[model samples]
Target: MAQISNISKQLQLKCSGERFYELFKNKMDSITQMFPKKLLSYKIVEGNGFAHGSVVHWKYELRGTLEAKQKLHMDDTNKAITLEFIEGDLFKDFEMVAVKGEVSDGGSNGISSVKWSVEFVKANEGVAPPHNYLQFALESTKGIEAYLCNNN
Candidate 1:
C-alpha cells in the first residue's frame, strides 16, 4: 500500500460566513453533478444535504467510456464539510480518497477563507504521486471556485 498523502489549499472570499456558506454549499452540489450521463448523480440519500451520513452517489469518469460508482460520506459540523470517498472507482483501484472543507472566521478582514484539502492513497506501493490525479483535483477546484466567485 502507498503512504497517505495530503494536499491543502486556502482561499479568501469577500463574503460573510452565512453568505459564503450558502454559496459554498451550492457550489459543492454543482460540482458533484458534473458526472457522466448525469444518471449517476448525488442526492440526499439520508438526512439533509448538509448533515452527516448524507450519502452522495456519482460516477467518476475514467477515460472516455469508463465510469464507476462513487459514494461520498458527508460530515457537516463546526463550519466544516468533510467528504470521504468511501466507495468509488478511484478508491477501489487506488487506495484512499477524501476531501474536506472548513470556513475560517473572517475576523476584521471582512473576507472569509475556505480551507480545502484532499488526501490520496496510491494504487502501487512504490510509485510517486500521479500527475493526472493532481491535475484533476486542481482543475475541479479551479472550476468550482471560478464559478462561485463569478456568480456570487
Candidate 2:
C-alpha cells in the first residue's frame, strides 16, 4: 500500500477573511499574474472557472518550470479551498497531493487566520515529504497579505 501523510500550518493574516476569501475564491486566475515568480500562468480547462469541480491547468516555477492539472473544490461556508493534483510533476514522487486552505475570523479585532493543510501519498516508501510545496504556500500567503496591505 502507498504511504499517506499530512502536514498543516496556521498563519495570522494581516487582512480580513472576507477580503482574502473573495480574492482566492473569485479571482484565482489572477494569482499567477500577481505573483509571477511563484506562479507562471493558469488556465481553466473545465467547469465554471473557480467553482467547485473545476479543473485548472497551472504552469508554475517550483524546483523548475512545472505544470499541473488540478481540481478545485471550494467550501464557501468554511471559506476553504482545496486543490487536488490529478496529474503533474508531483506524481514523480507522490502518488497524490491535495492542498487545502481555509481563511477564518481571528477575533473581535477582526484579524484573520489562514490555515493550509497538505495531504499526500508517497509513490514509494523512500519519497520525502513535500515540505517545499508547503513552504511555497506559506510564502505566497505572506506575499498576498503584504500586497493587500499596500493596495487595499
Candidate 3:
C-alpha cells in the first residue's frame, strides 16, 4: 500500500486576506503575470474557471521548464482552495497530491496569512516525499504578496 504523508506551512503577508483569497480563488491565471520569473504561463484546460473539477495547466521553471495539470476546488465561505494534481512529474513519485490553501487575518492591520497544506500518497515507500513543492508554494505566496502590496 502507498504511504500517505501531509505537510503544512503558514505564511504571513502585509496584504489583505480577502484580496489574497480573491486572487487565489478567482485570478489564478493572473499569477503568471505577477511572477513571470517563476511562472511561464497558466491556462484553464477545462471548466469555466476556478470552479470545482476545473483542470488548470501550469508551465513554470523550477529545475527546468515543467508543466502540471491540477484539478481545482474552492470554498468561498471558508476562504479555502484546493488543487489536486491530475498529471505531472510529481505523479511519478506520488500516487496523489493535493495542495490546499486557507487564508485568514494575520492579527495586524493590513496583514494576512495563508496556511498551505499538502496531502500526498507516495508511490512507494522507497520514494521520498517532495518537500520542495511546499517551499515553492510559500515562495510563490511571498511573491504574490509583494506584487499585491506594490500594485495596490
- Cα lDDT tens digits for candidate 2, 65-128: 9999999998999999999999988899998999999998666777698999999998888888
- Score residue 35 of candidate 3 by CA lDDT: 77
The C-alpha stretches of model 1 lying farther than 4 A from their native spots are 24-40, 43-50, 60-77, 126-152
Ranking by TM-score: 2, 3, 1
Runs in model 3 lying further than 4 Å from the true structure: 106-111
Predictions: Cα RMSD each? 4.1, 1.4, 2.1
lDDT of 2: 0.87
**Per-candidate local distance difference test:** 0.57, 0.87, 0.84
Report residue 133 deviation for candidate 3 (angstroms). Answer: 1.1
* Model 2 ranges off by over 4 Å: 1-3
- Tens digits of per-residue lDDT for model 3, 90-126: 7777899998999986555556789999999988788
Native-to-model Cα distance after best TM-score fit, residue 42 in candidate 3, in Å: 2.7
TM-score of candidate 3 relative to the true fold: 0.88
lDDT rank order: 2, 3, 1
Residue 147 alpha-carbon offset, candidate 2, angstroms: 1.7
